[model samples]
Target: MAKVGRGLPAPKSKRRVKYGPNVVRLVCEDLASGMTYNEVTQGRGRPSHSSLYEWRRRYPEFAEATDAARAFGAEVCGDRALEVAEQATEETVRKAKLEVDTLVHRAAVLAPERWGGRGAGLRRAEPIEVVFSVRRFEKVVGPDGRVCVREIKPEGEV
Candidate 1:
């Protein structure tokens, strides 16, 4: 029989991100052009998403710049949505509306202060619907002889 070693595997070294002015500039440009954080972090030679977040944590200026760039990206997405709406025709109306809706949703999430929750731009197609339910509780004895409160289903419910 061959002898097998029982030692732990070697630890992999972490990728070191090179911080530079151009790195920040390029990241900001992509963000300002409406690219998401995951999108920006993709591809070879780019820093991982966590590294970008770490940089933001390490440098307050980078955080602020990224925040501003994200807001600009939201605005850019909003503009693109508007353009899509403007160019929609009878045949393309459904697809155009879907694209515009997606872009507007992204914009609203990215920059809530600008276009979220009844703001001046691009309100949702339908008003939000809220439902309320009253749950009934009943005391039940468990197999362990412990009493616990359980939810009681309403009548005619399966």
Candidate 2:
């Protein structure tokens, strides 16, 4: 019969298993290839399941790579939005400048004296006839045709 101490079997060995880079790579590959936790555990010869989970959790490089990928996607989206906003702003400024230029050109051609000189005298023109009204004339049948009375506003009112 085997001897027992403190109701336990005797200690057998103290040698620790050394896992190389290849082993670590194999573990990472198996994890990335859609393997279940149990599958990875079994494939890796059932090494401490908690240890595998801890490796992924504690590795800074792995977390950094994942974060970088997400940040790159966000950067692309942000750049596109920035480009669209810049283009819209440029178009708006261009249209506003063009309208200003057109108004300036029309004013220059129509009344150059107002803009060209510091204190130019404005030219006066005769009042233009706008419309003819028929309210004052009575309707004549065949001979008189229609005599229309033209009405004009007071000089200052116009």
Candidate 3:
């Protein structure tokens, strides 16, 4: 048995599925349509989640394609949220609000650069100038042998 994590034997699969272009295409298309990875993999003949991840690790192009698909999916979710909100009836208003909230949250997480809240991806650095004054107290022995305090100011200031 092949060793997996922490010396545990890898689970045996009942079937071996081969990776192919068709699988990639199906996954990307379904994902672009707003289907979750779990949902897409649940279809018949679809690669298992583990297998899909393995393929991603082994293939760079697959990873890039899936990433783009997910971003597109995020936009789809945003659109769906709008549709849900617009079609909400008094009876279904609460349910529609919840659905819209969930979709918006998903879009924010999936494509933060576009749908994330303020400060998600847009930030500008500006120079800040700070001005301050410092006062120093010095203890002095006066001619009367009594201690006196005087305030000393920093250079370039009165």
TM-score, cand. 2 vs. native: 0.26
The global C-alpha lDDT for each of the candidates, from Candidate 1 onward, is 0.88, 0.49, 0.88
Query: For each candidate, how many residue pairs have backbone atoms clashing (under 3 Å)?
Result: 0, 0, 0
Better of 1 and 3 by TM-score: 3
TM-score of each: 0.63, 0.26, 0.67
Tens digit per residue, CA lDDT, model 1, 6-84: 4767644556669788889999999999999988987766778888999999999999999999999999999999999
Cα error, residue 121 of model 2, in Å, equals 66
Q: What's the ranking of the predictions by TM-score, best on top?
A: 3, 1, 2
Best by TM-score: 3
Q: What is the lDDT of residue 113 in candidate 1?
A: 75
Query: What is the alpha-carbon lDDT of model 1 when measured against the actual structure?
Result: 0.88
Looking at model 1, report the run of 10 residues with the lowest lDDT sum.
5-14
Off by over 4 Å in 1: 1-15, 120-158
Question: Clash number for model 3?
Answer: 0
Per-residue alpha-carbon lDDT of model 3 for 74-152, expressed as tens digits? 9999999999999999999999999999999999887777888866657656899999967789999999999999988
Error of 3 at 127 (Å): 14
Shift in Å, residue 92, candidate 1:
1.6
